[model samples]
Target: MTDQTPRLEAYQSKRSRTAVWLALGVAVITAGLVGGLLLIPRADRAEPIAVPTAFASPSAAETPAARATEAATRKVTLPAKLLSQPRLTDATLQKLADSMTLQFKDTAPETEDAVSGFYGNLAKQKLTMVIAIDAPVGNPASWASGMTHGLKTSLNAGPFHDVNPGPLGGSAKCADAKASGITIAVCLWADQETYGVLGFYYRTSASVTSDFVKARAAVELPTP
Candidate 1:
C-alpha cells in the first residue's frame, strides 16, 4: 500500500512540472510578437537613408540587385515648384555656391557672355546646381514644366509634380533678373537609398535646366 501511494504522488508532481513548462513557452512567444510589432515601419514616412552618387557617377555601394530593388521604392524628392531663397541675389547666390563648393562643370549653353555653371554637394547623394543664365526666368510655370521633364529624364524616377504658385507667395514669384530674383528647387526622392538634386532658375532659358542636370550628373560635389 505504501509503494502504491508513493507512485501516485510522483505522477501528480510530474503533471505540475509539465503545466509550468507550457506556460513559460506561451510567455516567450507573446514577448516575441510584441517585439516584432515595435520594429514594424510607420505607414506615413519612408526611412531616410544614405543614397549613393549614382546620378553623379557610375558607381554604388549596394549590390546591383539591391540597387534595382531600392530604385523601385523611390518617391519625389524635390518640390514641384521653386522655393524662394529670400536673399538669393547675385551676391547671395555667389555665397550659396561657395557654401556648396561650386566648381565649374560646364558652360551655360544659352549664354555667350562667358556663361559658366557649377555643381556642388548639399547633402548625402544630393547636389546643388548653379548655371549662369543670360537672364532670370519670367514665367516660372513654363520653366517648371521643362525642369520637371529634365529631372524625369535625368533621375531614375521619371514622374514629378510641381507645387502651386499661390501658396509659395509673390516674393517667390517667377524669376526677374533685374529685381534680384532667383528661383531654386530642392528635389529629393525616396528608396532604400535616398537621393536629391537641386535646380536653380536664373535669367537663362528653360533649355539650361537640362544642360545643368547633365553637367551635374558627371561632376563632383563637396563632402559633408
Candidate 2:
C-alpha cells in the first residue's frame, strides 16, 4: 500500500491548529472578563465621609431662664459653718461678683449652665473668688472638660481632690487659665446632686493658683 504517512501528518497538523484556536478563544474570554471587571463602577464600593457644619452659633445673651438659674445657684450658698469667720463683705462680694460676671461675659454662653458665686479680698485689691455653676445633674467630668474650651488662654490641670461640702463625686481643679488676659483659677465639683465651679484671681496665673489652693477652705461649697 502507498504510505499514508503524509495523510496522517496532515491530519495531525489540522488537530494542532484546532487546539491553538481553542486556547486562543479561552484567552480572549478571560481578557474580556478582566476588562469588564476593570470598567465596573467603584464609587458604590467606597464609604461615604461625614462633614459637620454649624449654621448659627448660640447667642451671647443670657436667657431669662439662665439668669434665674444663676440667681438660684448663688443662693445655694456655702453654710455659715463652712464660711470663714469675718464673712465676705457686701462690697467685696459685689466686686467679686462683678469680676466673675466679666469672666462670664467671655465664657458663660459657652456652657449649658448658669453661673453664680461671690469673691472677697485675698489682700489689698487682690481677689480670691468662688463661682458656682448650676450644671445638669450628671457627669462632673464632662462639665470639667469644657471649663476652658473657648477661653483666651489654655488651662493647665492640677491635682484632683475632694471638696469640703463634698459634692457626690467630689471635685477636680484646673489653673493657669486666662479670660481676655486676666489670670484665673477654676475648680469643678459636684454636691452629689449638682455641679459648681470655684475660681481664684490674682494679678498673675502663678499667684492665682497658689492662692486657690490656700483659700479652698475659706470658700463656701454647695450641698447636694
Candidate 3:
C-alpha cells in the first residue's frame, strides 16, 4: 500500500492520452472522404466528340488514265457492208476531175487515184472522193452515220452536222461547221446506188457540203 495511489494516477493519465490521439485520427479520415467526393465529375459538365464518315467528295480534275479508258470503251456502229469495196474507174475519175474544176475552181486537181486512193493535192484543199459502183450494196444512211461518227471520234472534235443532201432526199451527209487542224469540213454523200466523200483543207475557204452539192449538180451519174 506504500505507492498504490501514485501508480493508479499514472495509469489513468496514459489512458486519457491514447483516447485523444484516436479521436484526432477519426476526424482526419472523415475530412479526407468528403474532399474526395466533392472532387468527382458530373455528367452535365462533359462535351460530346463528333464522329466522321468514311467516304469523301471526289476531286474536280479527272485522271488521264480514266479519260483514255473512257475513249477506248466508246462504241461505234458501222454498216454490215463497208463502202470501201468500190473500185476507182477512169470514167468516174474524169467526172471527179471535171467537178473539181467546175465547182471548186481547182482545174489542175491531179488525179492520184491510182496510187493515193484520192484525187487533188493533199498539200492543198484536196478531195478524197470515190463513186461506189458495181460493188455490194449497203445502207447509205448507215454509211454516212458511221463515217461522221468515225471522224468525230478519231479527231476528238465536234460541230459535225448530220445533213441529208440532194433534191430527191435519197442521200446522207455529215459536214463540219468549219475547218481546223486535221478537222476539215468534210461531207459524205451516200445514196442507195452510189456514195461519195469530199474533204476541205486550209487551202480552200469553201464549205464541204456546198462543194459536194455543187459537184453533184454538175455531174450526172449513170443509173446502176
The best candidate in terms of TM-score: 2
Candidate lDDT scores, in order, read 0.30, 0.39, 0.36
Residue-pair clashes per prediction, in order, are 9, 5, 0
Tell me the TM-score of model 3. Answer: 0.36
Candidate 3 local accuracy as lDDT?
Answer: 0.36
lDDT top scorer: 2
Candidate numbers, best TM-score first, in rank order: 2, 3, 1
Off by over 4 Å in 3: 1-138, 177-180, 203-206, 217-220
Model 2 spans > 4 angstroms off = 1-75, 78-115, 122-125, 152-168, 179-182, 190-192, 203-224
Candidate 2 per-residue C-alpha lDDT over 75-132 given as tens digits, one digit per residue, 9 for 90 to 100: 2344332224233445434444555445543443222333344444333334344554
- The lDDT, on a scale of 0 to 1, for candidate 1 is 0.30
On the 0 to 100 scale, the lDDT of residue 61 in model 1 is: 46
Total colliding residue pairs, candidate 2: 5
What are the root-mean-square deviations of the candidates from the true structure over C-alphas?
A: 27.0, 34.5, 46.7
Across 11-75, the per-residue lDDT of candidate 3 in tens digits comes to 65754443343224222322322232223232211122222434433443433323323333221
